[model samples]
Target: MVRIVPFAVEQWMDEYETWAKYNIAETCSASISIDDLRSLSDDPSRDPLSTSTKLTYGAIRGSQTLRSHIARLYAPPTGDDSSTTVSAENVLITPGAIQANFLLLYTLIQPGDHVVCHYPTYQQLYSVPESLGADVSLWKTSGEDGWKLDLEELKAMVRPSTKMIIVNNPQNPTGAFISQEVLAGIIDIARQSSIYVLCDEVYRPLFHSLDKTEWPPSLLSLGYDRSIVTGSMSKVFSLAGIRLGWIASLHRSIIEDCAAARDYTTISVSQVDDRIATFALDPLHAGKLLDRNLQLAKRNLGILKGFIDAHRDTCDWVVPRAGTTAFIRFSRDGRPVDDVALCQMLQDSKGVMLVPGRRCFGEEFKGYVRIGYVAETEVLETGLRELGEFLKAEYASVPLI
Candidate 1:
């Protein structure tokens, strides 16, 4: 039996994703039409992919070609760090990053083991460990610190029993990333304690265009033998429909173990889906998609910043440096706003949808909401207006608590 609680964010998305007219809640990559995908088929290089057989379960450890592509994505372009080119043997394909986490936690954690995880992250990073009976310590991120995870606090929390540390970079909801220096420090901490780091780096490639000159750090490179990075085509590729993802590690044992655990559920990703994902990762196509997402995040973020500026007193946000979403607080007289009520009222009155912070960040930050402002430009404009109207009409700043 699955002991984990039902995912509240998914529940909200289920009911409203289709129903909402102005959905600013989605953090999708550049939307594509079916024809747009079909257009990729026109490429002479991808012609052979169409005939890929589907009768077989596909390669057990992911197709060598697909894994090779994934491996290359993490390798440094040149110079001193070039040695980190992950091999196919180190990659394990999963249905999605969510499932990748499941396989890793199920493989590594035992009852009574300690796990330290960054909070306000994708819930499975912490909750799944708890459900597995690991004593979970949350390294909570605060708005006052720009939602950055504090290393000193994490240093205080680790114990001899700690087995794993789950981290999400360009993190969910808050959208803050750890610097290379910070990542190196974490790697040091993990090495000293003999802890494995499971980094959910789904948003790594989605760094905002504002910071294009610099690159996001990779835990696989930073943590040496003890790190595992998992990601899906979902976030940065806008390929949620494909149900494709992978886990990359330097240790072949972790990949082997996750593959063994994968036997219980999702033995292999779709043969056809794997082929398409492989096609999507082709150097040119992949580069094109990267450029598209960078443009979208840069444009939409500016729009979001303007909206935040307009309501500066009523709301505030630490502008995101990467990823499609940011954590925003709606306040009433300088206190946390009732985000649940606000989201409900907006849905009812304006048909708007925003994730309540409690759903992603946990109970301590209920006044905040996760807004994925990377919607179609017109849709986002109206969503912001709707949210503004509702904020003004009801909670116009008379402190309650």
Candidate 2:
């Protein structure tokens, strides 16, 4: 029947994102206004913005200038930009990271292929492969052990038939990441198996500076010949509205294949989006934009931490090392709370939106919820207070299980 169910998380967000008074369910850092892109574009050094961006179907090959801007982000040794960081040849523009991943899965995996993916992932990572008839294995993350990937499981799961391994770094929902050491280990496993590793590196540079984790380079830069990195302006860049993304690969074949497949889908990014994205990625403005977003997220994270601390008897979380969201488990006396019901009630009554763990990590994690720390500071504070009040009135007396 080819039933591809609605992406539960995105569907949930769609239903309530606009309904919420305090929208903490958002994954992007607040939202970027057109003025935000203009601020970056106003840089005197780069050529001025061209208002005459033709409304035609645009270039399937994408803008060379934009590709160059993206290429520079993946400076080589760690990035695949072999000739001076990365060349335009190595990039294939997509509508967003979601589409970038779709292209990779659509083009690379064949029916009956073996695919291993890090779980608690963006649903598409596994779902697309499953729909393609791939035998998929999950590499579970240990929230108790700090939401780290089980590299040992990766070792045990891959077989002679394994075709690819997928990962999301500065992962969605949990915000856990694979460090360079972890990256090296996974790369070695892929190399030994002679399989490609597709890393969803959309959350780069969101690394918590105060914490030990430093901002790491994309897997494309990490010296793996077959490593394919998918990234976008959506995450740390706070530009989901732009819908700009790309795939970076050392292997020319992957880029070519994805570009070819794209012809059947979105065809090309809108010219206006390409121009705005180019400006945002300009060297002088990129750091400032990233800094602005990181500051907003960190401030909200502090508020979230305080909320979590106040509810210590009922909840706990492995603090995220990077990115905007964290997966938190809340229970009533050591027993799992009905996370779906709790989230639904919170949204329906208090107008606070949060994604339930079931949407991200599957049924086994239904006791958890994904909280995003990227809204306006005041909104974040109020949302936490409302949530705290609800918890107090409802589950306060429940014994810690």
Candidate 3:
């Protein structure tokens, strides 16, 4: 008999494409075009005259140049470096960050292995491991405390069977960052237990401002040979269409295992895609793109914050310090609203879509919603106005519990 998957796949199937106003995808707002990418790949001196000819399966472990560029992101400064330096040998490119995550889970987790993860965070981090028959436990983060992970609670949940701890910094829905202190505490716990740490660093360097706050140092940078850092071009470079991502690890053994597992799934990424990704990694180009995105996110976040403040009685948010989305709690007279019903009503009435928090966390976060504000300025402003009007009308009609 075939064993069925243990995770909730049905919940995401229909909802994935339903929310975009332009089929609004709050998951990733970055846009990339074929023409734009081709411009980056032009090399007059090279013998290849056409882009289509370069479409063959490129490198099994990704192009050396591409891997070198990715490594630079985590490399230590040239002289008297305090941080660890990463090499191309330590990196393995994958289809996207999501695929890299799956590869890690498949490689590290076995049927009886136990994994600890922070909740009200990315669903895939826990779900994938659970599906593989790993015993998964949640360490909850409180919204009232700015969604900060409770180190004490984490300490309490550790078991001898625990094999790994998963973290998403500048967290998805809440946008709560894991501070250096919290990261150090976690590292200490992991080191004591010898548990591997899998950190999803896809949102690194997307901070609101370089001066606003110091982001957590990479677990790899901490010199923990067991730690794995996964990242992608989707969020930072605004090139999700290229579908380029990678996993970096100081541990040679884990890197080998992930590569072996990857052989069966993808073998290698597309050649043209890899070439364009390399071009996009040019320091000057990347710096300009990141700066533009940061400015846009800052402006849009302000618009969202002002809107939320105006409707404080109906909604409240902790205000994300980073990332593309924010989570908001909805309630009336201290009684929480049904998020599924609210989401459906808002979508049907105002053509605005918000991901229900039930999908992000478990049942406890039902009254919350994740909203994306990284769209064009006019779109962000208009979407919020529509949402506010819809909430007002709904509140006026429904009886307060």
The most accurate candidate by TM-score is 1
The candidate that wins on lDDT is 2
Which residue runs does candidate 2 get wrong by more than 4 Å?
A: 41-49, 76-84, 209-213, 396-401
Tens digits of per-residue lDDT for model 1 on 33-82?
Answer: 53565565546554424664646988877788888888878877567564
Candidate 3 lDDT score relative to the true structure: 0.78
- Tens digits of per-residue lDDT, candidate 3, 1-401, equal 22335333236436654554632335454465655544543453432124456466778999898898888888654563777788898999999998999899989998899999988777789888888888999988888788888889889988999999999876787877788788889989999989999999887767773464375667777887789989998886777878989999999888899999999999799887787777777664566666767888889888988998899898888888887878888888787787767776777777777777775467788688787677667877877888878877775543322
Candidate 2, run of 10 with poorest lDDT = 76-85
Clash number for candidate 2? 9
lDDT of each: 0.80, 0.82, 0.78
What's the TM-score of each model vs. the native? 0.94, 0.93, 0.91
lDDT by residue (tens digit), candidate 2, 346-395: 88778888898875569888579898888778888889888888787865
Off by over 4 Å in 3: 1-19, 22-25, 34-52, 77-80, 209-213, 397-401
- Alpha-carbon deviation at 335 in model 2, angstroms: 0.5
Distance from true location, Cα of 7 in model 1, Å: 2.0
Report clashes for each candidate as comma-separated counts: 0, 9, 3
Evaluated at residue 309, the lDDT of candidate 2 is: 89
In candidate 1 the C-alpha lDDT for residue 28 amounts to 72
